[model samples]
Target: MFHGLIPADRYYAYLSFRDIESMPNKENVIIIQTVGAVEQHGPHLPLMTDAAIGLYIVGKTLEQLDHDKSPTIYVLPPQYSGYSVEHTSFCGTISLSASTLTNVLMDIGDSVYRAGFRKLLFFNSHGGQPQVTEIVARDLRKRHSDLMLFSIFAWDLPNIAATLVTPHEFKYGIHAGEIETSLMLVILKEYVKMNLAEKEYPPTLVPDGGLLRIDAGLTYAWMTKDLSQSGVIGDPTEATSDKGEQILASLIASFKKLLLEIDAFNSHV
Candidate 1:
């Protein structure tokens, strides 16, 4: 039941040990692990917003692929906990320490590598844990030179936020804002509470021209409490299910293309 989002045939956890050992083109098979976080996403969204997005994207992408013609791609179980030290002050936020997360990912990568699978992709949906995944990927690469490991954020891959959202939202909606709320509408509509949606942004000390900002070339350490009273950084009121559909489609298409590329990739070249 947990694998309902993914096609049963392509769900990695459903296979037996022997099935894995005997899988064709083991080196070329891409094992995707969806990385997400359980953290406060304001009052309008569920704590599993990031996790839901990651799972839905991966599932939809795989569903669109032609298994007979496409590279062998299997979806691993979602990593639901991630580094969210910044949001720990808020209730419903469950964060893993940087070192603990690093170790957990390293162990997962090691297990995947040991299973004779040479390709692994850490498809993360949370903003706080990209660096952790990247570090684990590099460390695993060093340990196993032949393994092809990739770490990427779901939104960063396509970079569709700029085109779909307003300039202010694109810059400030890093948490449970317009983009995330819109996406959640598509991925987990029942959990979203549109009535409670509100717009809030962190207090900015300097003008837009100044270097100091929440996210930019120059930034400072900040917690959610320091930013907004509602634990929101963007305008969720701007979210619409129509916008969510568009974002979902774009993300699925981009992820499907990326998987094919990774399957045929030759790192040495």
Candidate 2:
């Protein structure tokens, strides 16, 4: 509710779409379409982990943009279910097939385009949905080439990976790893029971000789059963809120810059 515009007494009040439309600078509105997942995150973290991180990054970026008087980027409610065949073995992983996800994205993109948002960013946190996102981005580009569209993963931020952790940590930073666990610590600490933290590394099925490149394009070829029995890949015992805070700060800085550049680019093209 606090967009660096209203005073503390009036900050508790909220604004509607009409209210935003009535603003003097209504032409500069940007829309952020966030895609997340309702999948499992080991026993220590909640299933909403991906959505929480997506919302957090966009919220912080919006706050900074408000402070800078940049274009107002509306944070649309996140899409909670994405394409996640890899996590299908998990008990609570609710995921859509690739075709369904792509259809939903296309419909959402069309609705937003019709609403007159010249600049749009499809912000995603779940890497499993990349194929659906790719399809949607490609189609939208072909249809509305003039509209600026960007599909991204928060972890792809410039200088973000380096700033948040060391090279060794990065190597082991997959699935419910240190980074994810730390993020859950900061975002949903009450849900995490540190005593349940455990590490898992299943044997590789791909043959060492030449299987590495075999079916490389077959996304989601390996299911959770193929990966680990416990559905965990790295150590979560060392996760802490301090590390999450550092990652959050680094991500905010990177996102603010990216949004600004997108806004500026919209003006030209």
Candidate 3:
């Protein structure tokens, strides 16, 4: 581990209730709960793709922080099964209904709130579940007016990829594409079977509407099966370890800066 203070599991799973009590600071506690899903991501990527990536992001954020300042954030064991209805027809997807997901989060919030934590930040990686997590955050606020809750789904750190990676494949590569494959290459290399990584060319524009996927302002819902047969979109063949490293580094830098501000923010509402 880069930092010696690394927890046993890089999550709350390793800590006992007494451990939280003895912590030096509790006044501005923020539980950064990562939300992900176990679902099919093409043939090359593992079912835990989103969850594993979430863990990497969180771990890197903590690794680079200035612990001497006493950051008040703790990572909870991730909610590994989220809304994955689009991929449920596939063998690997485990999904929760919108209501069930919200209530499950509410249960987590109630327990953590009762334990005296004042804030909950949902760091969601699964794209299908941000709306659900957003509802959960609002539900917590409805019950506890004093709590601070934030829900976030994606990051634009890859905007820097244009200069780093030639013929950047991120825009077309939405699902188990180059960005994710590159990330898996860096974080879980052994698991990524590159020989099996096939390119999935998504329609750059919708068939009837001719709406450009990358250049248009669009928000249409469709199942994963409706798109790629292999459960993939974008070009995984373009992925490289260097690109992944650059992306992760930028992510850590951006997230760490925001984390510092969040640790001290006092909710007005």
Best by TM-score: 1
Per-residue lDDT tens digits of candidate 2, residues 1-269? 44332222222125466765555543456677789999888887888888778877777666565545676666665688888778988999998988888888888888777666666678898867765776788898789876667888877886455456665456445778778888878777898878888876546565445435222343235676776777776667767889888888888899889888877775353
- How far out, in Å, is residue 95 in model 1? 0.7
**Cα lDDT tens digits for candidate 1, 1-269:** 86879889889999999899888889889998889999999999999999999999899988898878988888888889899899999998999999998998999999999999999999999888788999999999999999999998987767466787889889888888998898888888999999998899877756887777786458777778888889889999989888888888888888888988898896866
lDDT per residue for candidate 3 within 203-262, as digits (tens), equals 544654555444225657777777778888778877889988988787777777667778
List candidate 3 stretches off by more than 4 Å: 1-6, 22-24, 156-159, 162-168, 204-217
Model 3 score (lDDT) = 0.77
- Provide the lowest-lDDT 10-residue window in model 3: 1-10
lDDT of each: 0.88, 0.72, 0.77
> Can you tell me which runs of candidate 2 are displaced by over 4 Å?
1-27, 159-169, 206-220, 267-269
Question: Clash number for model 1?
Answer: 0
> Lowest-scoring 10 consecutive residues by lDDT in candidate 2?
4-13
> Against the hidden reference, what TM-scores do the models get?
0.96, 0.84, 0.88
Q: What is the lDDT of residue 39 in candidate 3?
A: 91
Alpha-carbon lDDT of model 2: 0.72
| lDDT, residue 90, candidate 1 | 94
Task: Return whichever of 2 and 3 wins on TM-score.
Answer: 3
TM-score, cand. 3 vs. native = 0.88
